[model samples]
Target: MHRYANPSRFIRIADTIFPWAGGIMITAFAIGLYLALLKSPADYQQSEMVRIMYIHVPAAWMALFTYAFMALSSAAVLIWKHPIALLSAKAAAPIGASFTVICLATGSLWGKPMWGTWWVWDARLTSVLILLFLYLGYIALINAFDETERGGKAASLLALVGAVNLPIIKYSVDWWNTLHQPASVFRLDGPAIHPDMLWPLIIMAIAFKMFLLTTLVTRIKSELIAARVQNVQRSLHGNLADGRG
Candidate 1:
């Protein structure tokens, strides 16, 4: 596993996995959307408005998952000094931020119909909004320094620290009387959702994971290429200076 930390080796592996993951993502998305939008029954309570769950729930799940990935990569950077750790962690920020925005936007959309308001400072929603801010902060901090290593280290540390918020986001509803629904599908006893609706939601969840993987690998590839270009240009400039001296 550690051997794959070599950037060249990692890129080689990413190249091979990229296409298969992308194809799977597309297929899963098509099927999931069919089930979510067409086959699934409307909620007895929320009626057609429940369809928003397909998008909103998945976005929220992926947002949490991506941040967890970043936190783990940050741990690898700080503890093992893993070569690809910072890059992988850095690459995840924008993607995570995008999903967080989706979660917030969709939640607001859902709220207007269900809760009669477009916005609220409820525990779960507020925490998730904070998650968005955290992602933005991480992106900004990563690009704040002149040196890549310095910026990477600072961003890595921030990721680790921000992980504390994840649990807060997850349990905020349970711990408080928030308008946000508690865990229905992930309960310890069993899923509260019916099999008919549950299947599409599960498939959509898988689709979101596949999509995140596809984007993450592509972003990391770009980061690696940019690093190589910077190194080559520095070497060329140093050689030309030596010749002039």
Candidate 2:
């Protein structure tokens, strides 16, 4: 893991993995969508509206999963000073934020038909909302300083501190009487969901995870290229300065 901290090495590894991840992501999404839309039985209660779960639940999972990854990357950057860790965390923020937004939006769409409201101030909803804010805060902190290193350090610290919310988001449904349902996929004994619905949900979750990996790798590669260009310009400027001096 640390060996790949070097930008050159990281890029080499990412290049190797990117195409495979993209291909798997596309294939998984196609199969998952087919299963979700065509095969899964409609809920007896919510009927066709329950189909939203295929998107909403996965986005919600990714929202929390992305933040957890960011926090871990931030810790790596701060503690080990891994060169690419901060960049990886930075690259993941917008992607996570987008997932959070999708979760919220789709939830609202699902809610309108099921709950008779588009929005609610439930504990689970609020906690996930906070997760979205944390993502935006990280992005802002990372770009706040003129010195890129300073900005990265500050943002990394913020991410580490904000990690407290991840657990809260996870247990919110368990802790309170909320509009959100309890865990159906993961339980102490086994999954509560019927296998027919469960299979599509699992497939969709895999597709979303793969999609995130593909996007994160692309974003990090772009950042690495931009950083390399900046370094080259700085070197040229320094050489010109020394020549004149």
In angstroms, give how far residue 146 of model 2 lies from its true place: 3.6
Candidate topping TM-score: 1
Candidate 2 lDDT, 74-185, residue by residue in tens: 9999998887888899999999999999999999999888899998999999999999999999999998976557899889998999999998988999999999889888
lDDT of 1 at 92: 89
Alpha-carbon lDDT, every model: 0.91, 0.92
Write model 1 residue lDDT over 1-245, tens digit each, in one string: 48868889889988998999999999999999999999999999999988889989999999999999999999999898886888898998899999999999999999998999999899999999999998999999989986668888888888999999999999998999998989998889999998888988998999999999999999999888888999999999999999999
Q: Give the runs in model 1 whose Cα sits over 4 Å from its true position.
A: none
RMSD of 2: 1.2
Candidate 1 overall Cα lDDT vs. reference? 0.91
Residue 44 lDDT in candidate 1: 94
